[model samples]
Target: MSEDYQLVGSGLTVCEHDAPVEGPVVWLDSPSAVLEFVAAGDVSEKIVLARGGTTTFLTPALTAGVKGVMTLQGAPESHLGILSREYGIPCLMSVAFERGVKSSRGETIPPDGAILRLDVSTHPEGRVFIANGNGHLDVAEPAEVDAEAAAQAEQLRALMASYRGELPKGSAGDRQIRARLRTGVVSTSDENVRRDLAGGEVSDYLSYAGWNLWDLIAARQTEGESGLIPRQEYETVAFVQQWSTYARWYARIVEAIGVDGVIELGSLPRREIGTKVNHVHVWATLCPLFGRAIATELGLEDASARPEDLDALIQFGRRLQHGLWGGGPGFVASRGYAAPVLEASWLERFRDEERRLDDPDELSAFRRFNATTELCGFLLHYDCRAGLCDTGPYPLPDGGFLLVRDHFLHEPGYEWASVIDDLPHCVTEAMFFRPDEDVSIAINDIATTFAQPANYLKHLSGAVVYARDRWDTPVSEVRRLDEAEMARIAHRCDEAMLGLYQRIGDQSVDERIADGVKVYTRDMMMPYARAAGVWDEMVAAGFDELSDLARDAYPALTGGAAQQVLGAVFLMGQGLVPAEGLPPAPEVGPEALPVLHEIAIKGSCPDVDGDAEALEAAGLVVATAAGLMLTEAGHARHDELLAAQRESVDLGRLAAAYERFLAVNGPMKSLSARAGSAGEDERFDLVGQAAELVERVEPALRRTADVLPRFAGYLPRLQEAIRRVEEDDWSYLTSPSVDSVHTVWMECHEDYLQTLGRSREAEGSY
Candidate 1:
């Protein structure tokens, strides 16, 4: 099974998996123990959690204040779902089977890389395909539910039915889901998860079900974060590497600065003036993560001291960071309800994007629950550390215990210490005052709407698709009750599609939106193979709209026409299904390619006369710049693919083309239309650097990093990096740079042409 399936997708990671654990076998009944278990891993393992009955405290962990130590019992956060799943742990919900899960001597697989090993306690040769696959990632094998363990499973299911929250009627479809669980068939019900899906553990309530939510969020927190700007986790980490020389400079900024008086000294973390004097907002956003780091290093008492005490600040400078980037914001309590499962970046959610986008007219669960984004204060005391909570007696700088702030609406209501000349140092402690009730639905609705669904992806059709399936069934990967349930499932997918459209529409031309669209378009295009023949037909379809191309000269369109005439080929050959009459994937006559070109032409370049002429006239290639990063990412990818074929690409030719790309980009560079900040230009340089880096590192990458050995996670980041190359988003590909991912992909394709010793048009790069 491992040989056949490689689970590839984004968020790939490498963790130092040898971290210590309390022990392997755990009692699911103990909530505190479960919290400890979930708390154990950071970039590596999530406790191999499984359960059948009575996970009472798990709900609380999910609901615990976003800022504190809490965990979920039934499921850790959704992100951990992939970890538990990919690592081969089975979760069953009934004591009859659940209690009988382990032997004192069972083995556990480490959650590093893409490999997973299954260990059987009593039954060694049981099926291991339950959780393996690119699609259907959430399916779990119930040893009891199998024909071999049906009796035990039934007893367990019956017991689970009797134990907790009674199953709701008209809630969702679960039968089709259950049917597939026993067998390997996936119906439409298996696909989506949205709000309609009745059973998402609210982002906050996991603690109630008895798991530690804090450790879960902590694991979610990404390090190497600098300042309060919202940047993608991967981007920020890479960005910080570029800024490594300024560690102490920023640290000094922290030392000399106070929450008041805003004259922005640096261009890096920019400040706006007037009604937009949003500096206060930036400072507060940074406070949470900085506070956590300080508290972790020096006890909270020293950290809580006002800016003047200099003790915590002193503690800060001594911490030898591996690079300039370190902490930024803290646990941002999201309103990520069941709208569509959204992933909270351990970084971005806490950055000041919230204050920037904040509209006074809008209603939000965050504001409803409390007036601001910070949440630990509401969940954890009037002085939470005082008599209420049991964790510590950590000392303060002023010879007193640090107290929790009672009001989440503002910082601790303490006096500010005058740094230069105060007699006594002042300290401000944080507190949370969440009432003893459930705040899940309110919070989730707000955050979910704003969140980029599934870790930085906005309006992810994939998540919505998955959510609808879960919505149809309370438990995952089970079938729908019937056909009507299936219709509802499809409707939900459409609805989610609409929601995504609304979100995407909001960012019609934004870079995150544009890049995400291309990312999605490419992913969505995957199921349908992109043969060159397909492109020619697309152009023909849109041919009449393109004034530059005369229709008859091309005659009927060919797949190449689709490529030449239209920039994109969307839904081409969709008619193949009905026209596919008999046997072997239907040979749609030679005429098919031309039709595809027409369709593509109609779809993409119907009126490129505007942007194309305007930009080309300006000696700038906006379209080309738009695609550089994506293209370069592609170039690296094709090179990897070519190497795997025992046909190494010509590095010298690629380097030559890269140089050409640079020459054409001058004058032709569309400096005005580029995506990011003035600094983003520098960041874009990172893409160009990556292109050059891939060229430089190709030999090593081929030797050490090429692991076509796994599927899915393998080479998926290349998906982004690939598009960067293909699109010539680097500005090199558009005008003169021979180095383009499209050029690279094509050149690498030409290398394959060389390998096969076949003549291909790509050989002569015009």
Candidate 2:
């Protein structure tokens, strides 16, 4: 009979079911549809069966007095399911009624207004009874009821209720006890401590503390209010709270497992064990306890989510690029392009050999020089730009590239000199194999971290339980695997290592190339040259002819000031300059101005008694001209550079909108989730937080729209959503409706992707 029914969720009932609840069924496809239906004055008790997976839509429905909820599809432990269990709403997921139920005319089964009965008394899988016609019923069994499991489910429900805030509400005595536990001062008497530990009160306190710790961490990340505790001070407080709480949890564990359990774990000294285990026993016991506590606190639920995995990937990639590709031709080319002096020499060498390549030795020298020169030129021409490219700190062919080039050039007898002949192939090979090898090494490092038998056992135990909880694996069949099986699993996990590397590398390279073109374009360069009145000078004198003179003239404009001048010219071209032109005798920002003024006064206008305005104008012109000729060769290579800059600016603004959304809405969403189990006062406090965060959304959206016109429509919709929430209709925060905050946010997000000419599949959903 149970096999005949589609089981969605199995657990204890959240609320009492003295009798079956029969109600009219309302089938809605989305949160907006539900909102529309409810707002239309349909107040009758009904069971809502939504088509989508998100459970947040139920907030409004529940407020409107829903009898029950059943989703056609959703994970049993999804956020929606968690909310249902917390709200004590009779809920079922993965109903599959679309496939299972059909009418005589072949329509989908359980149409709106169809009467259905849900019986939660059965426990675990509740029974669903449908009234077909003339009072006849079609019964579906969920699962066989388990009494103990039902009891545990009830306890979990109670526990969730208690997690609303710091102190759980109850009789006066219970409140006092909770307060004492929270303060970490549970009666100094040894007998009282022992009794509480034995009675499971210690476990309860630890659970509360753990939840509070997570809440504090979340608050720290999202906190923005001024005059509140400084971030460092808050961190110190959190650290102390964690230490004290974990100590209590560890003490409870020791008490439960007994002295023999501690000794068997080999944490205690044998001599100290007879009387009182000294501080060593406690410290040793705390080590593993601390590890577990930290892991739990950090939410280490997935291997991919672990920081160690990311760190390992970065470390390996860095080593591969620096170790293998370092000092290669590509590296040399990148560096030579950045340094004008080096670039002039490198290009001259390449052109010289090009004319004499008929000889074998000349061909070889030209090949080596050309590869390095091209690589350096490529990086500079395509990857270095103001406000667009992210060319890290060092100029290209970075230190490693330079090292390789130096070795080959200076140490002709070096063994790697032979490798320099085929530098391009060497760099390409390194790029291809780096990620795969790095991933393998990273996985092995992780495996080694669990080399200790106890740690390995813990990891295996966690893996089994995770499988059971998430995948519903039968516990009896989930015994620890042999070494061969474990190795196979590891091998399977690494199957996509190369693909992952390629995907990341390709994305990074594509972005840099796009940025390089946009920032280093002739159109963009024209504005600077025109502003400096160097366009005609550069064209007549020739960039190569003027490069040395410009360098010699602005000898002081090296390091950061050189970069700043380039950036200032780019910004000026983008219309970031003041309307009145140069400010007084001193421009506060962009250090390049003072040096430019000095050079202009000295070289361009050395006569006229140093007239401040004339000198400033002359300095501006000279600076602009100097910037134009500085990287003149790079601009000649690509025509699409200016267009790329525009596209990059658009994408950048869109990205900023998303980042702001996360920063502002992330905390609000967290608070909303907690509000479900919160008491009235706490819920109100959560609402206040949502209001504050929502107020900032409109301005941010407006700012985003100002930068990119395509995003303008989102501002009004977002503003309206915030208005609704602030006006006391709080459901708009997560409402599935079109007017809800989440819906509007997603719409803006979708628009961003569309405008960027990127596909949803390519970007991937959150």
Give each model a TM-score.
0.19, 0.20
Q: Which candidate comes out best when scored by lDDT?
A: 2
Top TM-score hit: 2
Candidate 1 per-residue lDDT over residues 1-766, each given as its tens digit = 3455332211211111222121122333333444454455441322232331111122222222111111112222232222222122232111122111233334121122222222222111211111233232322234343674778546444423321121111101121112112221111121211112112211111111111122122222222121111122212122112122122222333444421111222111111111111111221122222222222222222322333222222222212110111222111121111211111231122121222213332212212121111122211111011101111122223232211111111111111111112110111111112222322221120111111121111111110001112111222232212323323432332233223223322332233322322222221111111211232333244311312111121221221232221111111111111122111211222222222222122222222322232222121211232231112222333334334543444544444444443343332234323422435446456455445534543443233223222112212333455466446555433322433433333333333343334454543433
lDDT of 2 at 736: 60
Worst 10 residues of 2 by lDDT: 441-450
Cα error, candidate 2, residue 22 (Å)? 0.8
lDDT of 1 at 662: 38
Superposition error at 87 for model 1 (Å): 21
Residue 194 in model 1: lDDT:
10
Instruction: Go through the candidates in order and give each one's C-alpha lDDT.
Output: 0.23, 0.35
What tens digits encode model 2's per-residue C-alpha lDDT throughout 545-597?
21222223222232223323322222121111122332222222323333332
lDDT of 2: 0.35
